[model samples]
Target: MVEADTTLAQVLRSNLMLTGTKIGCNEGQCGACSVLIDGKVVRSCAMKMRRIKDGATITTIEGIGTPEDLHPLQVAWIVHGGAQCGFCTPGFIVSAKGLLDSNPSPSREDVRNWFSRHRNACRCTGYKQLVDATLDAAKVLRGEMSIEQLQFMIPEDGRIWGTKYPRPSALAKVTGTCDYGADLGLQLPEDTLQLALVQAEVSHAHIKSIDTAEAGLMPGVYKILAHKDIKGKNRITGLITFPTNKGDGWDRPILCDEKVFQFGDAIEIHPGPPNVYFKQRVAKGEETEPLFAAAG
Candidate 1:
């Protein structure tokens, strides 16, 4: 029960820890805080407790479904890619549920018309995927189709996952707006060090000597990490997941202190600018490469 002047959104989010009821543009302008009150969707942020009747039951995001047993709309959201960044997903789902309960057979235009009255805001995904998800979920609710039938109902040959449903990011990839790991460098702090790969030239070797006295003076190179710098056990441990190989996982190196081990085992790593410019800056590495054939 809420106080007389308290908005349902305030009590649900701040007090009850229901952060799914997002608070956005809090003047009933954006319906991100929409909740079901007596089976009708109302913007919880704008509707005060005084307006709600005493006996009216409220249904929140938690009421509809849980993480264990997700609502069909929630499932449809992921399968259909209705949620991107997912700030407005809860409100959209609650509103769609309310719409389906009242009219299960809503047409495409019916979906468009209903959303025109009940406001919701999504900055990331354009409303096309939202409409697709709602309509798809409506099909399930109306008993015309099953959720799994819509999702992974491939031929019984069992060779494929789905019938080539394009991912939601396909358009974004084509438009060149999709963010990649290297692209995120712009968002990182200016002082953050970027790691660039510097491969050891030797193919097979025991690392007898290393000369980095001049390489340390290179521009933009903050520091270098080698096997000597490691403070703990060199080999990674504790990942034996089977009964047969329970305690035998000491077969790798953090850094090859005396041996190169393989063709691509990581050797000396330096923290510097992630570019070819940093490559030219390092001093020449002169070392002995000893080759020995493995004997079974």
Candidate 2:
């Protein structure tokens, strides 16, 4: 019954030791830590360990297939140049697995949409190769082509058209024996600490002041930190600023300075049990109310 709030990424890397799941951006925007949770793909970095405490099954790259028994998707990736550098391979493989699991015979458009919107592959391999690879893998999985036939399909010119050889992990991946980073149910001691960001209440407002007295005194609340508490470099890299229709300059803050330029900017850090902090934020209030309320 070990249960403490923890980051999914930390659990995967430290406890599961499945380093194949790369951590591109700690934020959920990047698909680097993408893994299937209960058969649905989710970004691990945004997922809190406490959210899945009921023992939901998780699947990471390791769970899909192995070098000896590669999944069809793996085989196609190699044959079609769907992978290069390989940092994003695990994510792509997992996503492709999800797509194939639901729709074993996906159309070209399906493959394009699945990869384009969900898995953010920045490698510039382009979708044409990926789509072709997925289709090829689907054919192989359906037993429409033999491994030997696939081998002869490869062109001698070294183009990403055809190749043969069973993906080493294909059998294991289809059998559901492979373990991905997300498959790990890393248990945390009951006393492990957790943290959540406390966003600002108003857009384009300065830090008039923060009243953490009541929150700090609340049960299970450990600490409340502001921008001043940031020890390391405060700015974010690779930032892009653009203009909005309102003619207002839309300059996003990689890390919020004292002034908040947007509505959902993170303003503070509330360290404690993850559940407790999240619940507090979800609670309805003037300053702490959610930006969007569900309709009845």
Candidate 3:
């Protein structure tokens, strides 16, 4: 059952459970609650049920594309870094789609003006990326370029210090569609647990009785591996200081046996959750963030 005064945003999120349609600034100043009504984009939070016609058609973010088979604009959003947070992305995408549907060849100013005329305010990507993304999508729509060619990075003008021989993996990397080893591992069929490294804090440490009684019993922890669990000689080979240094691969161990090597050496990689601290700010004046070693 639908409420009398409930907005389209509410219906998409609360009723239909299309949580991609984000709600922000409920007064409609933010375009976070954007959706299409009869192919036109509008702020869903301000759109009341009473304002709709009898047979009106509506489309939300879910109607746009999926992760596997994304729309060109959706792909462009990732390439152009326009859709950072979901709050403004759905509305901005719908609004952009509406604009491109009507005007296939829009200038940068046209995109900027179109967004301004629609009140498509975004907090993450300022506005330049959005405009650039719209223009790129317009090119794709105008059949000037293919989706695969979007990955080709343009070099400088003539006599460039570069070669044109296409790298096999360049396209995927450029389009942000390449899945690394860890990504492939996460896509495994079975439920896979994550490994979070708890490194040694000090630069050096003396041998002492290690304790994991508390850490092992923490919530969501599956296993806490010690040195004994490692089968082979713990080492990171290929660190050849001299040509004669070719014997044992005992530089860094799979797990610390008696002493901690470095300050941040991963001593124990306990089972834990993954990748939440990756929100380093974007190009358009986003906040700076700390970098850390990647997970496997």
The numbered model that scores best in lDDT is 1
Q: What is the C-alpha lDDT of each candidate?
A: 0.69, 0.66, 0.67
lDDT of 3 by residue, 1-296 (tens): 45546677766664565666666677788776778899888899888777988799887767777656667776676667665543466677788888888888888888888888888898766788778778887888788989887643556554324643333442333222344443355355434566767788987776476788977766677788877777765665546445666655455666666777688876776775432212312233332232212211
Query: What digit string (tens of lDDT, one per residue) describes model 2 on residues 1-296?
Result: 21244567656765556666767776777687788899988888777766874778889888887766667777677666666545667777888888888899999999888877775564656667668878888898889986555442536676653445335553433333344543432245545667667776777887667676877786787887865676765654323334433433333444476578777788777678745754665674311222222322
lDDT of 3 at 266: 69
Q: What is the lDDT for 7 in model 3?
A: 75
State residue 172's C-alpha deviation in candidate 3, in Å: 17
Each prediction's TM-score versus the true structure: 0.52, 0.52, 0.52
lDDT of 2: 0.66
Question: Is candidate 1 or 3 superior in TM-score?
Answer: 1
Poorest 10 consecutive residues of model 2 by lDDT?
Answer: 286-295
**Number of clashes in every candidate structure?**
0, 23, 2
Which stretches of candidate 3 lie above 4 Å from their native place?
Answer: 152-296
